[model samples]
Target: MEEERLSQQLHEYALWKADVARNLGLYQNFLESQDNEDNELILRIEDIIESLSTDRIVIAFVAEFSRGKTELINAIFFADYKRRLLPSDVGRTTMCPTELLYDHVSKESYIRLLPIETRLEDTSIAEHKRNLDYWTTLPLQVESPDKMVEAFKEVVKVKRVSLEEAKRLGLFIEDMAQHLEQVPEYVEVPMWRHALISFPHPLLKGGLVILDTPGLNALGTEPELTVDMLPNAHAVIFVLGADTGVTKTDMDMWQEHVKVFSSGGKKGLLVALNKIDTMWDELENSETVASKIKGQCVSTAKTLGIDVATVFPISAHKGLLGKVKHEAALLERSGLPKLERVLSDEILPQKQRIVRDRVINGIGATIKMSRDSVKRNYDGTRQQLDELQSLDVKNNSMIAHLLQMTRKETIIYETRVENFQTSRALLMKHVKEMQEFLNITELDKHITAIRKQMEGSWTTGGMKKGMTQFFEQIRYNMTQVSYTASKANESMQSIYKRFHEDFGLVDIKPSILSMHHYDMRMDNLAKRAEEYRDSTAMTVSEQSFVIKKFFISIVSHARDIFAKAFQEVENWSKSSLVPIAVQLKDSKTALQRRIDNLQRIRDSKETVEGRIDELNQSLADFEARLKQLNEVCDAIHKPLSFDQPPAEAEDIKQQTAS
Candidate 1:
């Protein structure tokens, strides 16, 4: 029953993520339809849409060897493999850090391994991620678990090497080398740098990523893992053996790799005290064992600088066995339920909240601004129609009023056209400035200068810092572009205000003139620029080729981003007031018709009615589009809910039978 409940929880989470992705697609479609020319906004929306579609909930398992981290992962997510998915025997099973995720694109199961020799180069893992040719791929026999198990053993395969060679590959530390001086060959190292597994498990298919990292040595050697991957994970579950308590290596791992995530005592970290079944033999009763485990949790929490509640006591072996056998009592005793609840209820929702906030801030804000601007235009037009509706054709005063208003509106139109030209020039000026801002010539020069400053020490760490500096400069350029955009928007709004406030002309503020829309786009731009940091999380040792690739890729990406943004600004500056200008032209035509009909008021009543009908049709078209804009806006703000899935008829029958 507990297993079924847990399965239901995972199913609902998957459904919710899928629904979110669906809604994101709808938003992308709406944005594309409206602003096909505005590439910046489209690109921003596309990025968000892509992120939503491929969103993965990464749960990193951090622990020393023999702590049953791999076993716990199997119990929680991979029992459906019907056996251990990872090699988790009595000895160290996971020697290389392995990432298990479903590759929905290929729809095939395989493992990709990076050769350990690559670590001798200066390329970061982030760079290697772009080139699949660098990794060795092994196909899994999905039809037979035994064959799959056999293939999986490659993750733990090791090769013996001389101490000097081992040290060169970052496998041997001086302290360990000193202790191993008596041994001729001091190192037995894993053949792979990293292992990437793609399997068709339901949870993994639902975008659950499992990172099973090797113990202290691997974490210590992999700077990118500590700096980027682990820090960026949604949650890090540090598994500890209950009998061993918090060992020295575990504390070191906690302080160096895990504690950073929980610096401010954040909720994205959890500690699992595994192998609690061992405690049962020492304690007299079940209650006593539970008490002893709780005591261990407290002691371990204090040692790890976390709260006792964060330390969960569980037996992965028992949990997997109990869950497999459908024994509720054993599953309950395993303490897996409490940990699973925390994940489903707290951690998953937190991830959802972060994604929701981004969508609301970026897409939702843009839609609201667009909808409101359209609504304002529609309301103003409807008011003019209403005034025309009530005016009597026989009234000479009405004709005079209409003529005077039309003349003023004509002046407003002329002034707006002139202001638009000025805004266009200003936009062009900013676009040129932005083009310069994103130009890689200066960036390349700066990078060259930094490389010179490094004096050929251009080691991985040196270049990594250089990359960080490079991204910072890119961020600065993006900031300048945003400031220029904001300035242009301010000019547009000022021009709009003169028409409405001074000339008493109809409100002509275009959606493009609205700062809210630009602000949202700029915010998204800044976010994408910030994400470049994540992309740079390449391990320093990959090779200098990675730096060149990263530089070109980043420059090209920047050009696209800024080019799209500048084009949007140009488009807005040129065409923002066009809607109001057209309306003004129509207003003038209507007034001219009214004036011509003034001499023959009673006779030209039919013509006046025709003009009114035209106005009504125009208003109707605007209102319909306005309705669509509002619907899209509503969808953006709508809160997502994942109500429980309805029970199947067979399940209900089985329950009744039981």
Candidate 2:
């Protein structure tokens, strides 16, 4: 029943995304029909449509070894097979970080594995994903569940390697070695570093992605998982063992990795207390067992410094069994239904809200500008028609007088155009200055210099100092960019105001370039760097490995932030002066047309009634085009139905306790 609910919700989400894309396509068509010259706006809309078409909702499962994380995933997503799909039993099943998704482009089912030896290189997992040569591929026969299971077992494969090789891979630590009974010549390690499984499941085809991660050791060795993949997931489920009730290693993983999401008020950070059947006793009554589980839930929540409402107690083992056997009572006793409901209720709506916000912020202003332009043209055409109808055709002197007045008006408009060009040149100078502050090439040079300094350092203190200086320099550069953006915004506003005062053009507010978000991101990166410098993991890892991981994870993230800022500035430069420029050109063309009509009438070459008939036809065309523009704007802003009924409080209390 819970699986059905999740699948239905995913289906609905996919439909909502399609609806949005269809409307955007209509808007694109409208622009092309009107011969809209704002190519940047059209390109942005196309990008948004492409993003909606290929977007994936990622959910990451995080846990230490023997925590039932894999079993829970099987119970929730793979129960339609009526059996366990992935290799999940006893001590350690998923030896590497595995990603389960559908390959829509290829439309094929397969498993791709990256060799553990890739850790010796400086390339990140994300980079390795783009190159097919680095991974081994195997075909998946979805028709037979047994064959699929046999192929999936390869994710759990391991090999024994020399101690030196293990240490070089950053998989062996002194703290773990001290727990061994005696020094060994070899250590056991996973053969694969990462796994990618593309299957044709209903939910996967609907854009659902599952990331099943390994224990703390693997997470520590692969810095990219902690720094990029997990943080970017739409939701994170941190699983814990009910019998052990949050061990030391579990607490370490929570504090180092998962706590950041919850502390920052990010939604969809859920705690699944798995293996609850261990607490079920036949000697005691059901009520007594329930009370004990409730106490454990309260205790775990307090220890973790999280809300008890966010903690879910469930038995993944029994859930899977009951699902396969088709027993409703057993599935209800497992307490898996409630967790699934909350996940579906929370994640889908949140994802929709994010997409909606992006659409509104990205192209909402451009649509409005297009509508305004259409209305202005319609109004101007009507005024010209009224003026021509009010004229007397038999009086040549009157026509001659009107022609002289129009010629003088044309000259005045020409003077204004010259002034506009001068102001535009000044605005371009300020734009150039802003671009210099955000140049990506200049930022890369700074990064290269800092990396070299850290590489040459002989002591840990020197390396730490180098990292601190790197952030300080980045912050300084950001401050300069922020100041320049403010100055440019002020200049743009002044230009718009002058046009409104001089001519009758509407006073449109130009787009402002805000740097608050980028500033906050840089500050967060600095905090992460500070924490890494003081971490025990850094102290135990080799010096070379430490430098490489720091640059790959932390520095690379900072570079991404700067690159986005640079792109935004470039977009602002293109779009800031568009509305006024378009209006000026339209007004100039209308004046020239009016002057030509009066000149023809004064020369006795055309009748006044004939000119009037042509103006009336042109006015009708403008009205039709204006109506079409309004309809396109309305479609783009239409609201989607993303409402989901809230779960009852009584249901939450029972499920949280169970």
Which one is best on lDDT?
Answer: 2
lDDT of each: 0.68, 0.82
Candidate 1 achieves a global lDDT of 0.68
Best by TM-score: 2
RMSD of 2: 4.8
lDDT of 2 by residue, 1-658 (tens): 8788778778776776776687678778777776545677789889999998889899999999889889999998999898899988778778999999998887889999999999888777888888888999999999999999999999889999998898788777777668889867898889999999999999999899999988755666677777788878988999999999999888878877777765457888999999999999999999999999999999999989999998999999999999999999889999899898887878866886788778877777777777787787778778888887888877888878888888888898888889878888887787787677777788789888987887788477777887888888889888988998888888788888888887866768888889888998888777766765565554344655755675667877888888888878877877777788778878876888888788888787888788889888878987887786676566556554434234453342233233
RMSD of each predicted structure: 7.4, 4.8
Q: What's the TM-score of every candidate structure? A: 0.76, 0.92
Error of 1 at 477 (Å): 8.9
Off by over 4 Å in 1: 1-39, 181-183, 393-401, 413-445, 452-606, 618-620, 642-658
Q: What digit string (tens of lDDT, one per residue) describes model 1 on residues 308-383? A: 8888999999988887787879888999888888877777767767777777755665556556555655665676
Worst 10 residues of 1 by lDDT: 532-541
